[model samples]
Target: MSSTKKVKDSHTIMTQLIMPNDTNHLGNLMGGVMMRWMDIVCALSAMRHCNTPVVTAAVDHISFQQPIDLGSMITLEGFVTRTFRTSLEVFVEVYSEDLKGTKTKCNDAFFTFVSLDEDTKRPSKAPGIIPESKREKELFEGALRRRDLRLIMAGRMDPKSADHLKKIFS
Candidate 1:
């Protein structure tokens, strides 16, 4: 738990073909299905970062930018942006590629996961995360504010008590 890992070390990528079963009546990929995929990839990234079992604590932000049609290839990529004492934040992006290789960003989201003790099944310390790239660093910096916001929304923290978010409101 004393070791720190780079964001790239926990990067995860998954691809799935949107089939009839994965679509809604309009032939667009169902929102639930997209969320499922995001959860899977994000969990994988979180587990990789912690090197231990983890559980999804929350889905912080999700934006459906565009509709992905059936028959398209969907790619989901995720990485650990930052780590808390016992939790980690993962950022995931989903893209859709058409038959002709036309790609469009479909969704982006942030997920939080809490590392668990293998025997006790209780919250455990997670390894630190080091963001190397500019984008990774940006996300790493923003994660705390996002976490603060999530806590406020969940009633787990007071708005005025948020470290990063209070600056904006103040």
Candidate 2:
């Protein structure tokens, strides 16, 4: 397989208020809610890259390095890591900023998304390539590593599942 290098564009979304609804009684943002936001932002980035609707196929990794407090501003930044015929892999980084203007990276994750045709609900091919840069190359390499690990895990589960998983993971 010829590796198709994709140039990733950084996209960011700013959200505020970890919120009582988005948090526990202790007022820390719930991991699930944060993850959902990350998915949305990453999907947006993929759509921008592919110029088509995208759906989350899998979340490869998520790590919470710090806690986000209620009412703090949360910034989610996403970038394309790589692309296949019909799928794009994205990496997202979440940061928390306090009233005092301190910003810290609270979480990071890698997610795979597939572009879909609205009517057919089938995978759609993405653009050939974007503008290549050093950052894009680095992110693509990192995402490729994660993709390899996911393939290994899928292969271990079952042969049939691995075949289906390969289509999505690619």
Candidate 3:
């Protein structure tokens, strides 16, 4: 790992064509299929940031804003939003592209992954993310709030202790 790295350093993008096998009977891409793609892209971003193998710890706040039809092109972009010890939070955005038209955001998700050491198979330190653009900085800050929410939801943290979340919900 280097001494410093930017969020752009770990950016990852993947594109897939929705096919019959990836869709439901309604001719729309299945939620599970989209989730799988999200996981893969996010994990790759985390790994790129840490320079090590990573494992998905949690996925939070997956929002499906639009339906992707079969035969449509789907693009998934991911980047590191923040880091916590051995864990890194990855933000992913999915876009649906039309044949003779533009691309629209169809889904967004946040994923957490823990870096792993190859030989020791233990949690390893991950590189810190240096947010560059305004959007990246905003997402970087939001990741901490989302992490607290995930911890509270998983019974690992108390609701009252999550100040960021309390500010919003309370």
Local accuracy by lDDT, each model: 0.91, 0.75, 0.89
lDDT of 1 by residue, 48-119 (tens): 888889999989767788988899999999999999899889999998999999988887989999999989
lDDT of 1 at 90: 93
Per-residue lDDT value at 87 in model 3:
86
Tens-place lDDT digits, model 3, residues 48-81:
8998889999989776789889989999999999
Worst 10 residues of 2 by lDDT: 1-10
Answer with 2 or 3, whichever has the higher TM-score. Answer: 3
Model 2 lDDT per residue over 18-129, tens place: 7789997778999899988998899888877777788998887687888788888888888787786787788888889999989998988888898888678789886555
TM-score of every candidate relative to the true structure = 0.96, 0.81, 0.93
Total backbone collisions for each predicted model? 0, 0, 0
Query: Candidate 1 — what's its lDDT?
Result: 0.91
lDDT of 1 at 71: 93
Candidate 3, residue 35: how far the Cα is off, in Å: 0.5
Q: Which stretches of candidate 3 lie over 4 Å from their true place?
A: 167-170
Pull out the clashing pairs in model 3.
none
What lDDT score is found at residue 143 in candidate 2? 58
